[model samples]
Target chain A: MLLNQFLLLSALLFAMGVYGVLTRRNGVLVLMSVELILNAVNINLVAFGAFQDNVQGDVFAIFVIAVAAAEVGVGLAMVLLMYRNRRSIDFTEVDLMKG
Target chain B: MTSALLLAQVEFDVAQNIAFAIIAAIMLISAFKMVTTGNVVHAALYLVIVLAASAAIFILLGSDFVGATQVLVYIGAIIVLFLFGIMLTKAQLGDDDSVEKEQRSMGALVGLLLFVVMAFALIDTFGTQEIEFGNPEPIAYVAEPVDANDLPTPVREALNISANSGTVEISEAQFATLLPEVQRRVPGAEVRGNNAQIADAIFSQYIIPFEAVSVLLLAALIGAVVVARKE
Candidate 1:
């Protein structure tokens, strides 16, 4: 397959993720969008890795996945806190120190 | 055994492209629904589909190990975490329905701009470069297991394979010239990453970063437990 296809797909997916992050009111939904963005990055890395016949792309993809997992863990912990104290996952209402 | 560039041409693209099309369609739909679905659980399920499709793409590209890790980590662990978060949160999202709708148009506009720029750049810069990966077959034409130690010093060093690595890949033409007493061409699967090379890379060039990642994962694990602990 042409490299363009994969690149275009990642780009489109990334845009959707951007939209999700910007529009989602629910905090979990926003996090989900972030996952979309991360996955798009992964596709790009893997595609480029395959394209260049280098294993470094795969290595970076692995690292990105590891970091993303940690990020989601920490992110969800924060989300849990938000839900606990606020009783709502609507991030727009999270103005505890917005002064 | 007669060994003279044993060749069978395999048509590489037809079914592969079709499969890619079908899988990519499923992925795109799931990704769209994931971000747009109002129900949190439904959104998570959509994410599962999207992630699984991503795994399929990875496998299609011959990075099976990466694909498997994607399924296990993203779908298995991360989505489960999202589900747990959903179940724990009261998730009262209706109070600001109007606000969600209002912001969505602006989001759409920005998303469109990003897409346009990205797609244009991609299509223009990499118009038709085919993904070059995975040799058609491994070169093994030795009548017997060619011991890495037995090969002459120069050839051994040139092959750069240690005796213990077991799996050796060298072009029959190349190998014949270097160590001419070879027998048959071993024709089978392509010589791409099947986790072995990835392991090699991780342990060799990326050792420090791999160790650092493990430490980071540990930190995240402890931090998660501590933060979730009630005061």
Candidate 2:
């Protein structure tokens, strides 16, 4: 496969993720969008690792997965707290500091 | 090679490329649906497909270990976490109008702009580099003194060197440290397997970060318990 193919795919996926994050109102859905972005990054990392035939890329990709798992765990917990407090997960409502 | 007329080195496996195209198309469609779906449950379903397809892509890229982890961690655990979040938040199972903003054109515009910038940058920076894997051949000699018996049996017998000989052949790919001044670049041994290399890196150079991640996971675990508890 051409390096461009993988890179272009990753770029497109990342764009979709950005769109998801910008448009989604629910905190959990936005978190899902973040997962999309992370997965796109993993694709890029693995592709670069394959091109170089190096294991470092895969190592970091795995690390990204681990961190993402942790992120989701904490992120969802926060969402649960948001729902418990406000009876809603609407992200725009998170305005405790708003002037 | 500089001419825009000339294409990149077009070496690709026919079967693998076809597989890649098919899998990528599936992932793209599911991901698009995932982001656009109004129903939270439907979006979660779409995410499952996207995550599974991404795992396939990882395997296609020759990182089967990473692919397996993607399946196990992302789809198996993370997606479940997301669904639980949706359920607990009382997200409507039916299409919900409030899931999207009344004026969402900004996101579309930004996404388009980002894609264009990325396309231009990728094309400009890497126009002709082939996506080639390194050969697993041994291509270095340490030039350090070593007993002939220390060499692999095949190399030792093939070289027919005396036991007292100091120099030993080593593949630089196997031993990442290339003693530039003393090492002679030459094909002599085969590089180890891919998973072994990854395992070696994780345990050796990356040990600190590896342990740190474990600690982070533990912290996240405790933090989740503390934050999600009833107040």
Candidate 3:
């Protein structure tokens, strides 16, 4: 029962995250959506770990959290630099790489 | 009819269900807001609520370690990093009057489709199975009982008669008799087994991954510094 609930919730969260990533124009919001996707993955890991009577899933979740922290650290710094140079966080505005 | 009876029985344990339902609702609602809210700070705050609720759910699932780690790592560190990003990026503090409604509708459609597919998959895989989480059986080991003189016996008797028997026979009577002796030898080792066994596996067997995580953190720190450094 709990496992199903977890699966449902994780799926929902993941879907919302995907939509956010796909549609959002703000770079910071996109990063936040990525965080949501990472979190959904963590939930699935912990839920399956509990169901299987194994700690490996939990350990993997911890690793995911660590990776997420690192991602946010570098990602945010880049966003900051972009905003500083371009004076805007909108993805449409920063198309210097396109030309 | 039988399902109704089971539902009634579950109703008596409303405390557990209530917390689960509330947290699940909060998580879903905040996730929805995260995508819909144009204000970056508000979205980050909503994400914090989602993370905290998920952590609460982890605790309810008997994973205390994972729950605490989630709280510490996600809520404490990751959200703080997000806020720092918002601050450093000089995001407009006021209302974002520029979000395109057409994009939002398109995103909603995609999100809805993804949800339907995932829901179907979950139902296909786990819908028929019943969730069962009875209390775990206690671990038992044979050891010589200390005499009244506080002296340990040299030759330990194999109280585990099932192990000795070729047929692997163990009666309830034998288990009842052996239980006290097992408890004495392994003090505080109740029905849950050795919790420390997890720590042992992590430090001994999975030491490489643990060290690699530290290295990853170091690299991230350096990268953040490099990115943030003034030109």
Candidate 2 residue runs with Cα over 4 Å from true position:
B1-12, B99-102, B134-191
For model 1, what TM-score is found for chain B?
0.72
Interface RMSD (Å) of model 1? 1.1
Stronger candidate by lDDT (1 vs 2): 2
Q: Pick the candidate with the highest TM-score.
A: 1
Q: Which pairs of residues collide in model 3?
A: B138-B191
- For candidate 1 chain A, the 10 contiguous residues with the lowest summed lDDT are A82-91
Q: Residue A34: error of model 1 in Å?
A: 0.6
* Residue-wise C-alpha lDDT for candidate 3, range A1-99, written one tens digit per residue: 457888888999999999988777788889999999998998888788778877777778878888988899888888888888788888867666895
Give the per-residue lDDT of model 1 (tens digit) for B2-55.
Answer: 233322212357667888899899999998888777777888899999899989
Give the interface-residue alpha carbon RMSD of model 2. 1.1
Q: TM-scores of the models, in the given order?
A: 0.81, 0.79, 0.80
Rank by DockQ, descending?
A: 1, 2, 3
Complex DockQ per candidate: 0.79, 0.70, 0.62
TM-score of chain A of 2: 0.97
Compared with the true structure, what per-residue lDDT tens digits does model 2 show for residues B1-231? 455322332334667789989999998999899888888988888989988998998898888999999999998999899988988889767776673454468888898899999989998987767677554434334434455656555444444556667766544353455432222222343335677788999999999999999999999999999999986
Look at candidate 2 and tell me the lDDT of residue B27.
Answer: 89
Q: What is the TM-score of each candidate's chain B when compared with the real chain B?
A: 0.72, 0.70, 0.70
TM-score of model number 2, chain B: 0.70
